[model samples]
Target chain A: MTPSREQKLWMYEKMLVSRRFEEAIETIYLEGKKPVFNMAKGPIPGEMHLSNGQEPCAVGVCAHLEPSDVVTATHRPHHQAIAKGIDLKRMAAEIFGKATGLSGGRGGHMHLFDPAVNFACSGIIAQGMGPAVGAALSRKMQGKPGVAIAYIGEGAVNQGAFHEALNLAAVWKLPVVFVVEDNAWGISVSKAASTAVPENHVRAEAYGMPGHLVRDNDPYEIFATAGKAIAAARNGEGPSLIEIETMRLAGHFMGDAETYRPKGEKDGLTLRDPISRMRARLIADGDADEATLDRIEEAAQAEVDEAIAFARNSPDPDPADALTSVFV
Target chain B: MTNTNPARANERKLTIARAMAEATAQQMRLDPTVFVMGEDIGEFGGIYGNTRGLIAEFGAERVRDTPISETAFIGAAVGAAQDGMRPIVELMFVDFFGVCFDAIYNLMAKNTYFAGGSFRVPMVLMTSTGGGYSDGGQHSQCVYGTFAHLPGMKVVAPSNAYDAKGLMTAAIRDDNPVVFMYHKGLQGMGWLGTVPGATNHVPEESYTVEIGKAAIARPGKDVTIVSLGIGVHQALEAAKRVAEHGIDAEVVDLRSLVPLDRETIRASVAKTGRLIVVDEDYHSYGVSGEVIASVVEHDLSVLKAAPVRIAYPDVPIPFARVMEQFCLPNADKIVAAIETMLGRQTVGEPS
Candidate 1:
């Protein structure tokens, strides 16, 4: 029911990597586009959807997941993809549009398809729902010891596909967990304008499923909630929806001006950053010292730097081969 | 085209990306109602440098970054335009039009017609197009034909910086919904790498290059080559190589596709009596087909020889660079096609 100190530390390490990797991406995604901002003028062109402040939801939920367990994520998929244990270097290369990338540079940022770890994501809204539901169904039919997690954003709750997937998972009692990373704002439109309900977890009641809400971007609460939900799903009880009040620290996309954000909201978020809070919590609880945490942070930085370097040095796929993988 | 004159300092060169942003900035300054909206148009400057630096001047309210809700924001631009505001909305990639087709095809394109000339929808839907650096099918597409084919929407695709600024100004001032598609390869973006000479000497002052007219990019006498966007650059390269062989190939950049610059095509084809239509879109039901049709419908006698089409094969764009390049229209392919057409070389034999 509770994580050991080593297990908590492991979660910290994963969380640290997610944050450091995204920070690297933020810097690299802006490579030559600055002083004269051009999105198409960077190593990572196209849309860059970052999940900077939403690390806890991924690390907490994925700590209990295995390589065999299926995980489907949304457009803002960096944190979850990293936590799901997909190849970090390959992911960076994928974002770089290189030959050595996970999808051979085919999918780019939003369409990272790493099937080795049963991890994949899509760019469209609520696109991962059916795949998550289907993956869980196949596992159940084969009597396999695995579950599927459909990770979506608060904005995706309004999409009809999300509701349909949730109902299907619940009615069929599939081993799937619907995780909503509720970051409050969706592009420029707020949750208040988009959704009818105040909270996303409450909507799970409509599908005859149990709902759990975790607040404050707290990993402790998120881990507790996700543990029980996954335990139940793995035990063949049913599906549960876990909504975490995550933070979207950056703009909707990398270049977003964020004028729609309330004044002082970004500053407030910076102060309440989940990483600093967790570092403080770990020290206060006697789980880890500042020196140890610093070492972990340093190790994470090294790993991220190596991954980025690999992506930067990797050769681009031959333009003639773009037609190859369409079939097999 | 480079203006080689010391006194013409105002004609300093600019990229399609800078020219487009400059035009939007100028229009926004003149007209209070002229605003911009898209996924990353604000501080992040648009995905293709189309709205760069506007947010710092006009502030976020005017140079807004709407949520990724394309269906809502694109339709909102139409609604705002109908209500007396000029909104320049960008749909990130032209390939993303499927998710929000109603707002674009129905409301933005046909709203004024449906209202029976009640009100005008003076809006600009600027988007990125082209396939060269392997962004896969979604990010890399020159589907301006689809926009041009949809009756009410005026399709404007500019190849150089001069026309990029001119047509953007015209699109802003026009009282009809205009779809401005700028190819990524001609944007002078350093990341994807661009064709040399894509930048041109664009004048500082705002000017409108008349819509429905084509510009003679290069002059020749033996054959006429018509193309736009990245294809125009490829055509120019092909023209220079053929000139060495004494086979003249005139290049006509059909800047606006919707207005269908038939007059220019007819005039050019009439002069040379040989035609070649080059397009980055699919081979079927595309600009190439329409250009060839315009020539044939006018007079069957205009053709001294059978016309040729250099275009992407009918298939979804591939993500692998090798496959994409094979599908793309390039200078070598154009040269080979010309060589075969002129009987100087045989088919399937490299010149």
Candidate 2:
């Protein structure tokens, strides 16, 4: 299906917005003028898997999915959440644990959920697969072709749930696509330390399913890979697993000691970053110019600034809220 | 004396598998939102045929099977519950619990509170438990105790076909997460017939035994035998044998473990003054401990004999039949414990 050029542009625009949002957050977080009202913003001291370099995976996959198609994301799901149409104001509020956050200030960065937008985010590593499988099962039962996408990290491949979910999805022919964002590092430990086979995609073969790798830095490649897998799943061909290869531009988290990463490695990968590639493609192809790119950046900046201001002004959740919702 | 029950008269018998299948079918028919999922529940009629004929009756959508991923499907039930569908997830056996306990404890149990009062998960987890047949240690376990240890989870351990159908119906209709434990031994033990003297009449009709309610299976003034799950049958048999010894023991069947029937226990203990709590779980923090604690905490004066609790020894269940027999509490053990509490020396003890 040839998507309208306008739709493609919108996808590109949303991707740019997500990238700029991260860039803007990193800037404000570094400057000490934190967007989070509660003396916080960006990643904590240890490790934050910044999506700055890997914007295309989020852009291409989200481009094919509608607002109603449920998505389950891992810890580094800022781009997924933003691309899926979560309000920046609420997302920033949620990151700050402000009362106005999407998760009602309970879930910080890893646990972002906008059920209204069919997105449930979790910080627990490899736990998203189960919920994503369940979401796909629910969609299938409802007779909706709503394919669920689970955005995982290469680190999560070793988790038992990752294997269990794939086995079940393949057996039941559930409408789910498992996307392993193989950034080659599980925090400080590289993929070599985690799985025997460094290529995480091959693990899917053991479960009797096709697995392949996509150039994680290319938006076009990510879109095609995710699109094919998602289509196969929605068409009732069961589930497929995709391992996307990219590199983390920042530390595992914010302020992470980069001792584990070879010196100048992040800087080197930053040269072939996905966001920069998309930007170059848009401009070189005359799809968008420097002025238009400037306008998009300005709009993203204004929106992010407004969200920070809102999060700053918003109140914290009441302590009494802790006792609520124990049971329905 | 606790109202009319035809099954008790030895006129009816039905397999636990048949009882559960009937319950699942009736629930799906009664509520459009109810569905079932497990490993091979669809094309294979479940590992035990408990879900037989369901896939055909409800089609693949309602009676779907899944990969052997307990954590995913179980957690999926939580997500599906949040969106307004009542799901009954089968874990095949209680031993597979390690793969899926987090979804029950962390996610489904506390989702409402974690969501800051914005959401709640309404799902039923139906799984087989207890050890008698040589299904090995892994397949033979009573993990309902672990579930009873957690708060916000309602555990139903029905001992017979009647309670199986009744309690399961309630669990399905429940608004919170309910863990329904099915004892492999008691499937065909309770309801002996499908109708009055028909020999196969277990009610095709549906009913619910409210949570936190206990049924007094027998009334006596000497001692109260508070038991649940397959242990209820053991307690009943012991009561009958104790009657021969001139000891009138009252039996209170605690069908639900979490919202325990403390009032029934208190009332029985108040009258009997001696309590014998029997559970298939191990001796530590199992349902027996909870029952004994509730009796002591609420009605301390009712104790006549240090509240005898008969339970399996604290150890991983051994695979051998003889070792399993030694590990589990049986009718003879319950009867002996009652005799000991009554100042009469019982079996397995030297004077």
Candidate 3:
């Protein structure tokens, strides 16, 4: 369960990359639309959902995924998309609506699809559950290797799709794992207001599957829990559900004024930022020295910068080309 | 008959239920990638007998009897299809679609398009439809029109045992997401009773009837009787009944609804100069309207008399057998509608 020196460094670097990418997206997403707050006027128009502080959830689970393994993610998908090896330049370009994008600008940030790394996502909550279960079933049926990891938010726990998918995965004994990233906020609503249960993982017991709850948004804890579940699936064992407590460092969407938030509630989330915690842990755990960690952080930010620059420089798609991909 | 399997060489007359199960068994034998799943589909062989003897032949892993969780299993079929397996997942009944339509329309239908063709969902969503035995509102329905109305889905339903086997074969072989809807009334299941003549001589071989094509069940020059599913049976009977009135009626079986046989419909209407659509689905905003619109859109001048539609009334099918029968389209109703369309019925005559 312990992360090796290299694994810790890898997780730390990935967290940094995810953080910087979200920071860049958040900035440019609000560029032209600010002050006047016109959502359609930005370089990245329409909705921008960023997974800022929830870096550990994606990094830990994806660390277990192979190139052939499938990963279906939620709307705030850049983190998982990056962690699962989506082409950075193309993904950034997709968010920018450029022709060089992953789906040729058809699917924006929320609807990212990268079959190269076997990654797909959508704006709908709990929609990924079905496809992930299916992918697991397919691989098993064909005697092919590789499991599927489906990521959803705690809010999705209440959805029938989520319940149905979990029960199917368990009953079929498919090679799949359901990861619930409990950020505790579904837009303005909190888990206390929306969820009837105190935890989503225990609900997996209702379906005869083992469920684990990872506290503190810790990457190492997530990695250990996800490692066991993923290995079990790969070894022909049944599926498992993991609920990781995480934080939303940004608003649900860019330009969302959190006026509904109680006073000082927003400030508390910044104190538990996973990236900052990971960097300190990496130093304290003797995985890296300050100099080594500094180099990794700088390199990660440089990669993010290149991706953002590539997105900005990419060409816009022709309006006529919009009708091409509706069918095969 | 060209029989691929030597054992069934002498068997010519197969019911729609047997034809479907045989088609599935043949496909499974031909391709190991194809499998069947749904509640009661395994040992119970499905309520409508669509998967009869599948589990005994294919085993549990390949022919799974899933929990009554439509959303998960259907979604898994879509995922499995992308992973290079052809999965024929049953929704159990068309009425049960409400519990799992998101997986059907969103993932199964739109994923390939959303992925820009990077993924191919070679999955077949097969389910039982139609209502003649008073299964109540929740159990009986021919809602293939809803799937046909959506984009990125191939919707097909066969009227007889011969087409049932062929269409099921074709649907399994197609790369896109195909909704293979079958009518319960025409399945020839002894318990529910079958539409007479719904069972016919079907070859015991793996063959695919072309999707999006209509069949001329009967030909006439005076008027066209356009319908599908159980309506095809009713239309044929109506055509025979109307012949006594000296009004020859053509019968067109619309096998596929999404890639609708608009060409066949238009051609039949043109030849007959009159049209009467009989459908088991609801009247407004359904396949019946789509059939009429396709004809008029291509050429409005082809019709001599105003077209008429004999469809289920826009109401929940009542529980009582008599009340449900009142809402259903039948041969007599189709005959009455044809009489009115051809200007032969007197207002006082019993329809």
Candidate 4:
């Protein structure tokens, strides 16, 4: 479906928010690395897997989901969390390890959970797939209209949980949409070298579900496919698999040297960046003006700045409360 | 004459499997959000008949029979629980946990704590455990110690029909993730010979047996016998045999492994001055060892002698009946351990 000018502006704003938030995190991470690099000495004192060039995948898929619809994401989840409407202030506080964080300073960047929005992320590879199936099963059992979205990296499609969750969702006809953000690398190993099949979407046919591949970093194309799959799932047509081909603009982790990447690959990836491509398309089609797009970017940066400030102002959790929350 | 059977009306003799089914069915009926999903759990009534007649009553939507995928269903149960649905996911055997340990340990158990108490996984992972009918190593393991060792899970192993019903009820209502393990031998199946008293009087109305409590099967003063699941029956049998020789033995059935009733163990051991832990799990670094350490930590002076433990040797369960019987903790082994602890002549070797 062709999105209106307003919808295009909203998408641009959301993607900009994600990009600026990630950039802020990266800057803080590097600042912590200055002088002497100790992982524990950072404002975000954990392994940060920033989604630098994968904003389209999260924004496209999550745009179709309501606040009640559930979404589970992988370790690299800031983009998905932002797209799924998680409070940026709380999420920033969580990443900063503050008392007012999403998990009250318990869960760091990789383990963000917002029950109000029914959003969760797991550090284990393809681990969120199982819970996504479960949320879908819950919706189906309760006769609710909400569907669940499970986001996994292309590298994690080969994990056992991925296959099991797909088979279960297919057989049970659960309303879950499995999104594979194929950025072409499982850390250092290329997807072609590690995954059994070159195209991960082909594996969906084995489970008797429709699979589609949305090539390139086009948010509109992603939105179209994701919208169809999500609509079909909500209509009780069973699960669908969507693999969106994107690129990783930065290293897998903040400190990753990225020696495995081919020479000049980093420089070449900048030409196809999703955010810039979407901005050009919006301006060319008269859907948005350059001034409007620039204003959106400025507002996004300001919002991210406020989030960082909130996180910095938040208090650290009490050391004595460590033993609490182990159980209900 | 009008039939006035208050005794039968108030309570009924139910097998462990039947009691478990009744408890789950009652929960499903009372809570619209509670549902069960597992292999052969729907139309087939479960392999052990623990979920018999549930599908017919609750329909296929709630009483679901899933493919042999533990990770998916268990993970789904966690998700559903997080989404406000109380789900009971069954893994046919605890041995099958290898395929889905990541979901159980990383997600179900740790999610609440990891989420900073913002989320609660109110789910029950019901699975069959233990072996006596030569089910081999894969099918016959009381892995309660393994689950209890994990931080997030609440492990419950009921020894009789009464506790089976009550504990199942409690596990369903509990806000945390519960690993409800049922001993296959204690299920009281006619085809599979049951341990004595595995089937007991269960109340008609719903009730809860506290998750972190211990029950005294038989009270005595000479020695304290600590056990759970089928080991409880074996300890009681040994208690009877030891009483014949003027040695009074007390049997403590530990219904819950995680919230272990250390106070009961301390009070009993203080009175008896001797302790023997009977466990079907591996000997080293298990419940038996944990019991010993708990008693020692609480008050070492209360022990009249170094406590003895009758547990399965550190090895996989053998397939051969003779070898399996030899390795498993039985009444004879308990009796012999007690005799040895009392500085008396030991009984014959385990047959």
Model 2, first chain, TM-score of 0.90
Which candidate, 1 or 3, has the higher TM-score?
A: 3
Strongest candidate by lDDT: 4
lDDT digits (tens) for residues A14-44 of candidate 4: 8899999998898888766778777777678
Against the hidden true structure, what lDDT does model 1 obtain? Answer: 0.84
Cα lDDT tens digits, model 3, B191-309, are 88887667887886678888888888888988899999889888888878777768788899888897888888999999999988888888999988999999998899998988888
Error of 3 at B42 (Å): 0.6
Q: Chain A TM-score for each candidate, in the given order? A: 0.99, 0.90, 0.98, 0.98
Which candidate, 2 or 4, has the higher lDDT?
4
- The TM-scores of all predictions, comma-separated, are 0.53, 0.86, 0.95, 0.97
The lDDT of each candidate is: 0.84, 0.77, 0.88, 0.90
List model 2 lDDT by residue over A136-255, tens digit each: 877777786688888898889888888888887777778888888777888888888768885878888888888978864666777777788878887888889988887677777765
Better of 2 and 3 by DockQ: 3
Q: Model 1 segments beyond 4 Å from truth?
A: A1-328, B1-11, B345-351
Model number with the top TM-score: 4
TM-score of candidate 2 to 2 decimals: 0.86
The docking category that best describes candidate 2 is acceptable
lDDT of 1 by residue, B183-226 (tens): 98899877868776678888889888877778888888888999
Model 3 gets an lDDT of 0.88
* Top DockQ prediction, candidate number: 4
Query: TM-score of chain B, per candidate?
Result: 0.95, 0.91, 0.95, 0.95
